[model samples]
Target: MGRVLFVTPPLTGHVNPAVGVAAALTARGHQVAWAGRPEIIRRLAGDGADVFPCAVPRRLPERDASLKGPAAFRFLWEEFLIPLAEAMAPGVRAAIGRFRPQVVVADQQAIAGGLVADGLGLPWITSATTSAELVDRLAGTPKVAAWLDELLDGLRSRIDGGPADPRMSPHGVLAFTTRELLGPATVPHQVRLVGPSIGGRAPTCDFPWDRLDPAVPTVFVTLGTTNADAAGDFLRAAARGLSRIDGIRTVIADPGRAVGPMGDTVLVVPHVPQMAVLARVDAVVCHGGYNTVCESLWHGVPLVVAPIRDDQPIVAGQVVDAGAGVRLRFGRAKPDRIAAAVTRVLDDPGYRSAAEKVGASFRAAGGAAAAADHLEALLSG
Candidate 1:
């Protein structure tokens, strides 16, 4: 039996997909463990999970809409991603020594895991949580791209423990998104598009399932777990939008207390059993987080995507381009405009059909189990 080590960032979206794949590996009689912040890993992976502690930098609230294009990319890599890699490398190396895994599965965002594993002469796979790598927009800007390349080189120079390794591993890469939704692209031969690795997510909140009315169509609205502060006004606008509609109910996951005073038409809660809600909802209104969009589309639910920052605009564009949803301006979207968009998606069968088509692709792409098969194959070879 092969022992697989999952090195991930502390963020929930990055860690969740690996959880599913890890579960599949465990079921196949392989030993599985994680290296990241203990609190996050434990909460998602369970208390009994073999977790190697890694120090994570405290991320301050970031909702800077002013930082655009190359500047945003630089800020993300320099301020967050690179720092995370450097902080995690020591722990990753230590875990490699102790856990003695056959392979390392590093999240696409957790660059240190791949770098350190390369240093240790171990085979590692890139666990891409999103499809952005296949079609990165930064490739268009020569100066910015060259600067970013130099930045990565500098990171590797300072932190490189051994021979050079591509930031994305050449051995194998597990992409959780299917090409059907992301469209045609130049994907490496080693990269496997294994759909969304949505395993049994341990529910954080006990949802009021009884509160949901079957008579009315419901829209599940969320900004995911991370963007509470940035999405406050938008969430409030969505709540108001849904509230004004007749014979429709909306469930808003208000983790940051963003929405105030909900009526019978709107249910405001700190956390929701998102999978459960997704199963029952007619449509989704969310910031274009890849996980939420994919999960929603996986359930054949259409979306009204309001992009905020980072890869969200790209994700929103994908949603619109795929005809699976409507895209709205985050800061500029008024309650009336949100309501109209939601109405359009709900009323139009075309959007629903498009969402179902994407959902079918996701289902056929063979999620976690297929990902496990791919990983196991890499080890065998």
Candidate 2:
């Protein structure tokens, strides 16, 4: 049995996909451990998970909510990704020394895992939780692409890594999405479309099941874990919009406490048992976070995607292109627009049909088990 180490960032979206793959590896009699924040790994992966602690920034860099497009992209790499890799390099090296695994599974955002593993000549797999980069958003912008390349080169120099992009491993890339959502984007041979690693998450919240009215159409509203700061107005707007519609009920995951009080038709909580909620919801109103979008589609539910900064715009566009959802502007979307989008997705069977088709493709792609199979092949090859 091969020993595998999962290197992940503290972000929930990145770590969640790896959890299912790790479980699958363990089930196959292989040893699995994680290199990331112990609290996050343990919370998501479980209490029994062997976790090697990595250093994260003292505080996440604060960015203006107004930053978008190229500016947002630059801010992410400069303030977050670069600083994160620098902070985590030492700890990743330490984990490698102590664990001495045959292969490392690194999250796409956790650059240190790939850098340290590549430096040590260990085979590392890239776990792409989102399909944003696979489509190449920077294709036309040569200057931006060059700038990113130079930035990565500097980071590589600091970590003593080889001249390779950490985001795409030479060994393999486990993309948690199918071609159904990616459209005509060109992907490399090393990338495997393993779909969403859907299972093996331990629920973190106790949802009020009895409060849900099965008599009416239910919409699940969330902006995911990281967007609490910027989700206030959008969340409030969504709640207000969803509340006005007749025969429609909504469960809003208000982690930011953005939407204060609502009527009998709306249920607001800090967190939700997402998978459970998705199963029953008629539609989803989200910030186009990849995990949420994929999960919603995985359950054959449609969405109204209001994309925020970072990779969200790309993901939201993909949702629209796939015919699985409607898109709204995150900053500029008004209540009426939000309501109309949700209503359209709920009423029109085409959105649901498209979502179901995508969901079918996701299941056929073999998800976590397929990802594990690829990892095992990498070790044997």
Candidate 3:
């Protein structure tokens, strides 16, 4: 059996997909382990997982919450990405040495994985959890693009042993999205669309499955785990809007418990088994993170997307462009607006059809199993 090591940051969104891919490899008789935050790996990969400890620095506080465009990109790279790569370098090397993995599957955001593997002359593949980075959000901003290139180049030089292609691996890059949702765009030669790696045993959460009425339309709402925005207002608007609509039941995944108890029509919990909820729900109301977006469509569920920031707007655009969902202004959308969007998606047959269409493409793309095949081919070649 070949040994495989996965390097990823501590984020839930990134680690979850890796769990699926690793599971696929393990099922095929390959030994797989992870190098990341032990807590995150253990939580997602189960308590018995073999995980190498890595030190990730505390995120540098954002100078301003509303920073957008170049400023937002600057804050991400300068304060977080660069520092994260530097902090993770030693651990990445240590993991590689100890594991002696035949191939390293690294998350696109974890630059240390790609660079350190390059440094040590080991084969590696990129595990792209979010498709946001695949599209160029900075098309019109030439200066910002040039500046980012130079910044990344400098970071690569500092890391020093081998060639760096940012988050992508020259050997193979696995993107967990299909072009049917992404729209036509220029992609690097290395990236392969393997659909969303939707595996892993579902997390146990106190979900009211019995209470979910199969009669009325059910909407699952969440801003995702990493969205730092205050969701109380938007979630409240969702509750007010959906509850007022005669037959709709709203389940909001509010981690902060920010939203007050709305009546029996709406369920408010700090968390929900999102995959389980998504399976039963008719539609989704969310912040448009790629994981939620892809997963919802994977289950043939349409959405009412309210993009908060970062690559959210782009993802929302993809949903809209593909006719699978409707987009609303996250900050300014009123209760009525939220209601109307939900109603439209539920009532319109076109949105559901589009969602199912994308789901078909996702299934055909082969997901994690295909990703493993591609990775194994790297070994054979």
Across 24-97, the per-residue lDDT of candidate 3 in tens digits comes to: 88889998988899988888888878899888876646445477666777888888888888888888889999
How good is model 1 by TM-score? 0.96
Q: Which runs in model 2 stand beyond 4 Å of their true positions? A: none
Leading candidate by TM-score: 2
Query: What would the per-residue lDDT of candidate 2 be over residues 144-230, giving only the tens digit for each residue?
Result: 999999999999998887666799999989999999998888998899999999888777879989988888899999999998779
Give residue 214's error in model 1 in angstroms: 1.6
Off by over 4 Å in 3: 62-64, 137-140
Candidate 1 residue lDDT tens string, 1-381: 899999999899999899999999999999998899988987887778899988776663374756666677788887888878778888988898999999999988888888888877898999989887755566668888787777778777787754444446888888898876888777777788999988655666698888898888999989998776577888888888889999898999998997897888899999887888899999999989999999999999999998877888888988898899999988888999999999999999999999999999998988999999988997897
Q: How many collisions per candidate?
A: 1, 0, 0
TM-score of each: 0.96, 0.98, 0.96
The total of clashing pairs for model 1 equals 1
Query: Considering summed lDDT, which 10 consecutive residues are worst modelled in model 1?
Result: 159-168
Q: Cα miss at 340, model 2 (Å)?
A: 0.9
Q: Which regions of candidate 1 fall more than 4 Å away from where they truly are?
A: 58-65, 162-167
